[model samples]
Target: MEESAILNNSECTRKCSENLSAVEDAIYVIGGKWKLKIIIVLQESGNIRFNELQRNIQGISARVLSNELKDLELNGFVKRVVHAEQTPVIVEYISTDYSRTLKPVIMALSEWGKTHKRNIREDAF
Candidate 1:
């Protein structure tokens, strides 16, 4: 069952509404697994090339990463810059002001995960 369906009462319903709105906002920019990972990679380095992003994010296909970058650019979460002066033009991805705001949110989640995550056997992977 979804988390939204579990809040049954009126009071809980209001809280659930608020939670759902916040989740919507959060997911608007950070919806997919690779998108969040891409943002985190961009945060660590101010800008990166397509191949770099592909290498950093494990198991993501080139086509999927390309789609994710396009979606992020469309949403204003990431900026794509093409160098016109280069002999062969190159493209770089940079985080936008809107995406920069998510840094604190990512950091907070990282801290929380570190503190509360359960131990699992390496063999389970």
Candidate 2:
């Protein structure tokens, strides 16, 4: 029984290691300072024009925002829409349905951030 239990523990560790790789892959797809920020903005704004998005996210250059939007669209977390109805044409970014799955993750992060800030203040004193 002891030997069997040791084998089982080894197998469990191996499986966990494999699962961590998968989790890392998922993070790679969305892991960036700007990607999650852009996602959160799009989620709140629904369909937002390029210029508006740039204005909303302070300190982000037009070039960086464009690149991040393209990356998010490619990753299936965002969709880009071009409106021909506008005179010069209008482009908007919207969060995809799949990206809505991230709401809980974002919310959890927000809660943690709040707690972290409070902890920092307490520690400083």
Candidate 3:
């Protein structure tokens, strides 16, 4: 609620409460690296299983992926489908409509990062 804690010194305060609330909401949704990556992967792939996701993420540990999936589900960004049949159950993770809303924001950020990297590299060289 305080502008001092929300932003650093020397920064012009304009609608500090609104800006801080937006930042807080963004953090609440995409707080971790894994959550962002998971959302991207699910957005691109549509639907995937635990093992498939883990493989695609490269270095993400099993425990971390599991925890992230649970957190995503809890936050309503992802939907878990459990197929009951034989001994082992098949659980699939799919991006929910709420997560689809973030596609444009994520894609814009991705493009911005690419352009920023290109600019920096050209400046360096």
Candidate 4:
């Protein structure tokens, strides 16, 4: 192999490694069974109460939902609002503008998921 070829390969490997690191960081923040689902619901529903959000995400326990909400809030993906003055103290979760940055990622995943489902069904025949 030429020296230039070796150098090019090293650079390509470094770039690939860096890209994997970026993916890992994103997963750390938003990659879970419940986090993305919660984000999707909040983005679609505007400000939603805790119980309502829990119901929207069928099968998630309240404890798990609360923990996911805290993680999302900590990562700047969701915000918790409290209407303390109201008689019952309404609390709501809202998606942050920052979370909208995931729109393209979510769309890509949706497309890929559809494609994967189609391929699986075809193979099952």
Candidate 5:
């Protein structure tokens, strides 16, 4: 029984390690300085034009925003729509269903950040 328990423990550890690796990979795709920020903006604003997004994000360059949008679209987190019917074509960005799945994650992070900020302020005083 002892030997079997040891084997079970090792198997559990191996499964946890595999899960950890997958979580790391997911973070690698979405864990960036701007990715989550952009996602949050889209979540709040819904479909938004390129220029509008650039203006809203503050401090994000047009080039960087463009690159980040491309990455998000590639990762299935964002959808790009081109309105060619208009005299002047308009391109819009919207968060995809997959991206909506991150709402809880974003809210949790926001809550944690608020608490962290309060903690830092308290410590400083």
Candidate 6:
């Protein structure tokens, strides 16, 4: 039997291919070095100024953070609010309710990461 035929006949079926599509779509939206970190910070802090968010993340440049915020806002994951009432005025980025939907995903990733780190340490010894 050929390799392609074996794969087609085995576990890699149409359903699995469809699942790959969903994973790809997810990666397209949220796959990056800074996005999930930014979301996590906003999720924890509620609303934050640009400087605060930058300080929280650490090592991320202002230009990159600004670009990421624009992308997050465009995707409906966060909101940018300008408060004109205060003397100095305030600009804040807030996590949207839509962003809250990622809570389960974040929790799962955290759990898996912790477990993986433990496993790696165990193997090293």
The top-ranked prediction according to TM-score is 4
**Candidate 3, 70: how far from true, in Å?**
0.9
What range of 10 consecutive residues in model 3 has the weakest lDDT sum?
6-15
On lDDT, the candidate that comes out on top is: 4
Clashes of 3: 0
- List, residue by residue over 1-125, the lDDT tens digit for candidate 2: 99999999999999999999988987898887788889999999999999899898988999999998888888899999999998999888899999999999999999999999999989955
RMSD of each: 6.4, 2.0, 5.8, 1.5, 2.2, 3.4
* lDDT string, candidate 4, 1-125, tens digits: 69999999999999999999999999999998999999999999999999999999999999999999999999999999999999988998999999999989999999999999999989954
Error of 3 at 109 (Å): 0.3
Candidate ranking (TM-score, best to worst): 4, 2, 5, 6, 3, 1
CA lDDT of every candidate:
0.86, 0.91, 0.89, 0.95, 0.94, 0.94
* Cα-based RMSD of candidate 6: 3.4
For model 1, residues 1-93, the per-residue Cα lDDT tens digits are: 455566456668799999999999878767867898988888788889999989999999999999999998988888999998996899999
lDDT of 5 by residue, 19-125 (tens): 99999998988988899999999999999999999898989999999999999999999999999999799999999999999999889999999999999989965
Better of 3 and 6 by TM-score: 6
Model 5 earns a TM-score of 0.89
- For candidate 3, write residues 7-96 as lDDT tens digits: 754353666777998999999878877899999999889879999999999799999999999999998999999888845988889999
Backbone clashes under 3 angstroms, per model: 0, 0, 0, 0, 0, 0
TM-score of 4: 0.96
Please provide, for model 6 over 8-116, each residue's C-alpha lDDT reduced to its tens digit, 9 standing for 90 to 100: 7776677788899999988888889999999999999998999999999989999999999999999999999999999799999999999999999999999999999
Better of 3 and 4 by TM-score: 4
Please state the error at residue 24 of candidate 3 in Å: 2.4
